[model samples]
Target: MALPRVSALRASVRAQLSAQCYHRTFHGSSARTGRNRASVLVAGGAALVAGLIAGASRIQRAEMTGARVPTALDGKDLESRCSCFMAPPVTPLEGLRSPDMKSRMELLIMETQAEVCRALAEVDGGASFIVDRWQREEGGGGISCVLQDGKVFEKAGVNVSVVHGFLSEESIRQMKSRGKSLKTKDGKLPFSAMGVSSVIHPKNPHVPTIHFNYRYFEIEEADGNKQWWFGGGTDLTPTYLNQEDIVHFHQTLKEACDQHSPTFYPKFKKWCDDYFFIKHRGESRGVGGIFFDDLDSPSKEELFKFVQSCAKAVVPCYVPIVEKHKNDSFTPEEKLWQQLRRGRYVEFNLVYDRGTKFGLATPGSRIESILMSLPLTARWEYMYTPPANSKEGEILKVLREPKDWVH
Candidate 1:
């Protein structure tokens, strides 16, 4: 039997939202800030806006573009525009020229990002990338292409998610677990499950790395209530200090946020940092970007608009940086060391990452794509040392403290 297409699901959702009278307001505390510790605010009742002011320190920046914005969240055209805005062009799938569905999406997103990365690399002199991959104990899988190699970018790229059987009840359980939640029905715990192939990695050092994801989830009830949702977003990270990059990245994101709510960028940026942190390492993966999940809130139409806004922000925030950095020359040692750092990336995902844990626990999950973030090659050195108080050491210092990326 043929399975349901996501596009079809999206269309159905669009229609349902179009026919409804929907209005929502968002009120929540700001995300945890790294500095002030007390700047959290209670924003107005704009479901479009959630208030949160975080911190700042050292980093780079970038932007992206792709999507149209509605003047008000109350417009009738909101549903159609939001759905059309965020969905990837179908052409990439055709252009990917691959057999596997996941591979097709992976290659397509990679091809698109590589072109953008190459462009930014040409402009930035050069860039760096962080890559890692994982194995899913279940079925199906995916790979990520993150590029930050450029002047305009701090980092950016599309996260391609390809997974079959995503709507299975067991799969939903795995996803909830990753979020530190569990499934319960009739006042008792149920079985867990999930399967997927996904990837995320940026191509530049100056722009700081970033992440984005798209996924499907489901919950099944003994009484037959089946539910599902689509979730994902892009976020930021940096290695070396670059204030312009940080500001540019944040500002571009703010533009998208403002279209929806003045409070969005601030709240989501903070959320991005908190969401992507390596709890064990006591530091964020990079600077920060925007993130959202289980976005099935208020109404699918409203959530769709929010996702569209984030999707549009991607190209504007990241392409320029890639154009700036993809071609600069770097010594083989630097590249090798980059790979060595990649080793740490791998360690975090395999040993401490919630995503990895969930993916491995799900049923019908694919292994290769789940682990595709890993570099083609990587290394580990015994007791590697950074010159005391050097710029390199300075980055290490900040990484240890979870410093704010912007003031």
Candidate 2:
């Protein structure tokens, strides 16, 4: 290679890198200040841009001078930074070489899982998560963290999984039915899915139960092209209706979504209500939060940033409710109602949840992790019903008719 061409190569690298990095910035701002939050975002963006430019310049100079160099953004450096992860990443360093969205998504979920567990433990005070790392015989693995019977929380499970294998014929048919343009040579497609999923059921019926999952999925098409998309959502399931707490949850989620696109919140909120419905009972699983799937629109980078906003919104959305109500006194009847509501949660997950059914049907899937979302306690009396004009009846009415909580 001639020395003159080095300048051209450096320019090309800079252009490519800028294309990928420039679109990224902090996703959301505090809704209170009419978003002077933009100023903070711009400052952060400026810092990131400067750092990226300096690193590229350093690497270019090093190449020309034949000098050794290392960077914090390199995969090796990043692996060290992510040392706090519950388990080693699914993809080896070599396999994760260059244009590294796959590895970045993996790290994001790991970070989310860690953060959620820490926040819950801090609030619980007397309990910490028990981390369980396990591997799938066919492909990848996961870490499941559980904190059970805590002072505040009853049962909490926060899990991160990275798995890759061939999708079965039944799965293929299911995807195709959803309007996915997919084909299988021998009725199988090479696929990978990674995500952070959590279910937090508090001891007091006053503190609502929260559930969320954020995931990225990819499939290797028969033509050697890769097809990828993002999915997952967060929702609230309260034994007793508290309008203020529910409003706070919805508002936080709306703020996050609005930062991405004005349309995202409303569209996904409706999707959440519709998706979580227990068809047999003709009522929603919960008061709805944002739910979206098969999202491969606008651009990959933009969508990734949007997902990050939603993931970060989880803590702000649910933790305040926990702190406020953790010590609130409850009657035995209230506890009984909570258990009965949990029975509905179990029914929805077992019979209606696509994720649960998919995990159950998949070969070599970890059953314990799939079922970890179940609460420690649930009850179903034979055709039991809440009394007329009772508080429980009010909850049933709201569940049957979802509300626009944010507005």
Candidate 3:
């Protein structure tokens, strides 16, 4: 009975072991399938994550390289690494490969001021110009050099300025009224101007007082368009008329203008006469030189060359005249006449001179430099008339009527 019971127990144990083996095989296959599905899900997640990272990297690269970086107006780089807050980068016009006009004009004007001051100093012999360098809070700055009580010149000023800032609404409206092509989104307009202007007053009444100015102006629009121009002239005002001196002066300017264009002299000469006319006094300001504005056609290089020619001709045009009459003797009456003529100059500048108006209207302009063109002393007399057919009378006649000195 014990043997029979042991056999039955062994059979039962074998059946149990077989059942356990079959369950293990079947569950193992199901577990393997689940693990494979988990691996596929993980691989898909990793790929999705990689794609997201790649897209983010591309966006960051586009932000860095797609837009133009900003730079300071003075061409200096800003300290910050993030360029989004930087000043607008200088954008040249499409297909324009030349240097920036404002920068070029600034360099040219500064060089011209230095050269002119040096030459005038040599001619002065007794005094040298005192340079006053100043800056504007708005955008730019200038150099003002003045000489007083000199051997050849009583008072002289040579000033060079490079300014950039926003134009007032009134200024924009005025400019638009003058037929300037301007497009402003807001009332304000961005503008840049660079110029060199000089005024020379001689002690000797016989020597003439001369004025010269050359400038470049640019208006930048909201749509990245630019409007640029060149304007300038040189004139002579003598207390005593000297035919040879006046003729030489006009001829020098004519030659300079002719080098650029034959039409420029005649057109600009007439323009000068018309512009400098003292409408109230019904007389011309002085013996006319060449004057022109809105000169932008025929290419910027040509205009630049023309302006350079005019500037270079200045020393030759007036220096010899100064040297010639600087030693001449004059009476107190002649000196008084010179003062009266200066009064007329003051009137013209204060009333009708566009340069003076612009300078005074510009924000942060240096008043001293703007008014430096005025004589150190001026006199206004009531009903003053020169003796008929006298030296003063001859000059008055010329001033009252414009003449073609070169022809």
TM-score winner: 2
True-structure lDDT of candidate 3 = 0.68
lDDT per residue, candidate 1, 1-407, as tens digits?
Answer: 12223234334423432342212222223333442211111111001111211121111111122233322333222222222111222223333333422232233243233233333333444433222222233333332333432343433332334443333454455555557354355534333222222233444333344455544445554565645454665655454655566666666667666766667667777777677777765666666677655655565444545554555455456544443444545566555545555566667668765566665655655454456555444578887876857655666665566545446
lDDT of 3 at 147: 81
Q: What is the lDDT of every predicted structure here?
A: 0.44, 0.74, 0.68
- Angstrom error at residue 117, model 2: 0.4
Candidate 3 ranges beyond 4 A from true positions: 1-98
Poorest lDDT segment (10 consecutive residues) of candidate 3: 21-30
Candidate 3 TM-score versus the reference:
0.75
User: In model 1, where is the ten-residue run with the lowest total lDDT?
Assistant: 40-49
Model 2: residue 355 alpha-carbon error in angstroms: 0.3
Better of 1 and 3 by TM-score: 3
User: Of the pair 1 and 2, which is ahead by TM-score?
Assistant: 2
Clashing pairs in 3: none
Q: How far off is residue 331 in model 1, in Å?
A: 4.4
